[model samples]
Target: MSQNIFIIVCIIFVGLLIIAEYRAAKRLDSGFLKWVAKPAASLAFVLVALTGGALDTTYGCWILIGLVFCLLGDVFLIPTGARTFLAGMGAFAIGHLAYVGAFLSTGPEISGLFLIGSAGMAGFAILALRWLWPNLAEFKWPVTVYSAIIAIMVATSFLAAPGQSSAPNWVVIAGALGFAISDIAVSRDKFITHQFFNKSWGLPLYFGAQLLLASSV
Candidate 1:
């Protein structure tokens, strides 16, 4: 369909942009391209959700709005400065809340799954601290907290009704883990230590998480 092609095009464009960013070393465009592409991607998600066999088109459109906020948040993160960075994180937190709202639209079948995912998120937090704390040093708490939130949010998706059982659980799982990993690396790179490297890894992992999150819906 046209919408599917649009999504495909957005993905290809983002991938190419990332490659261009990497080759350019310091990023030449000020991330305006990130701005344009994300909304396109978000719109494509809504189109797919509405016309691609969803039961509730209205609900799907609203959920897609949450996705739009996330894309906007990514746009805000472009400056590589502290305020924009934190704002980006806040925007994503809101997006997660929107996702939570969407999941809740399915009712309480997911409560048990949510609890399980919460425990897993906590366990991951403890494990992350034990594993990365010493190496991370200064920014440990921030990264850990961010990852904890994401783990819970991502896992919470499983709480939604299996109406869309066609959704790929692995993509969701990868997205969850990707956010945790990339954010940890980002915190280290920005706040704690310079020992960690890999913009390539960070870019793909974080954006891939978003890409997968959008697709899983």
Candidate 2:
């Protein structure tokens, strides 16, 4: 399939997911909606892998691995249990590391700008941890570790591609930022308070980010 067709299909899936999730947020009887949407989100990435013309390269494969782990994380998080949450975190951590590997494989040149971005990511992680510390109680450490890994993933996304000025590079960076924002919404809704509206923004950011990352393939 052509890239244009793939993009259009992905967009349709994302729209469907957002609508389903919004209904779920409203406490409507959306049977299997979340389940369907989660996997469909991941499947969009798989489609990119198949059609983006990059599956043969090691870098592409690494990204594929990350996306698979993300699928696993999504599934694991669906069940309501602390164990499942931890399992999801582990899966996503591995996914982030895989993404980091993909970024390093490009042999990005170390620059002051890159270091600054890394520092910015670190600062955001620190602030998020500080805000969650009081409510974290038992899950503090695990969340901290997972957050750090995700921050690294976002930082690396900026430097993953060879050229900083390229459209692909910016797309990857935007996806990473969107992922970060979505996660923050998740954390707030899950740990601090129960806000249904969080899903409204978070779901779109998440699927959009995944679609953008998939396109990077």
Candidate 3:
């Protein structure tokens, strides 16, 4: 009961923080408030996982680690600059690897679901790169590699056992999709256009994804 309450509170807090950050971002303000609120939102999801007893299993621990890296990515992206941007990308890449580890913890299996999902994600990655490549400049290869890594992370979720209702694979898949959408929004805003409106879509997708993953544990 206590754990449930904590998770609820965290969810509420994440909602509020995401809204706050969205509003602040629209004002072109990556101010102290947004910086603080953005990370707080991620922390809330991490707390949800921890409080929900994700620490009880090895897979859960890997999930927690992935969330932590995402938190780090969030913080690293707060500042405006290429160095920090790359840092954030590196962090998120590692986070995706951690997620891949968590998904594989259950054991490996080759299934139609995995193949289909991987192919779809690969197609999306190609399209996204096709659009983003010209603008990627010196970051082209880095972005390509990271995109492939994240696609693999999403594909790995389909490898989870399918027979159980509480298997958490579906939730993981939803979260991975959310994460991918959020990143697309971010890339568009950062490289294709400069606008806070992107945050309107990005922040919610990101927080929602993290929360979904948290609940999976």
Better of 1 and 3 by lDDT: 3
lDDT of 2 by residue, 97-166 (tens): 9888887777777766678878999999999999989998889999999989999998888777833333
What candidate 2 gets wrong by more than 4 Å, as runs, is 162-168
Best by lDDT: 3
Q: Write the per-residue lDDT of candidate 1 for residues 95-206, one digit (tens) a residue.
A: 7777666655655464565677778777876776676677654446655665666666667666654345634255555655676677666655565544324555776676
Q: In candidate 1, what residue range of length 10 has the lowest lDDT sum?
A: 50-59
Relative to the true structure, candidate 3 has a C-alpha RMSD (angstroms) of 2.5
Point to the candidate with the largest TM-score. 2
lDDT of 3 at 81: 96
* Better candidate number, 2 or 3, judged by TM-score: 2
Per-model TM-score on C-alpha atoms = 0.70, 0.90, 0.89
Q: What Cα-based lDDT does every candidate model obtain?
A: 0.60, 0.79, 0.81
Return the candidate ranking by lDDT, descending.
3, 2, 1
- List model 3 lDDT by residue over 1-217, tens digit each: 4445655665565566656656665674537666666677777778878887788877788889999999999999988799999999999999999988888887766888889999999999999999999999989999999999988999888875422443447878898889988999889988899766777778778888988787777
Ranking by TM-score: 2, 3, 1
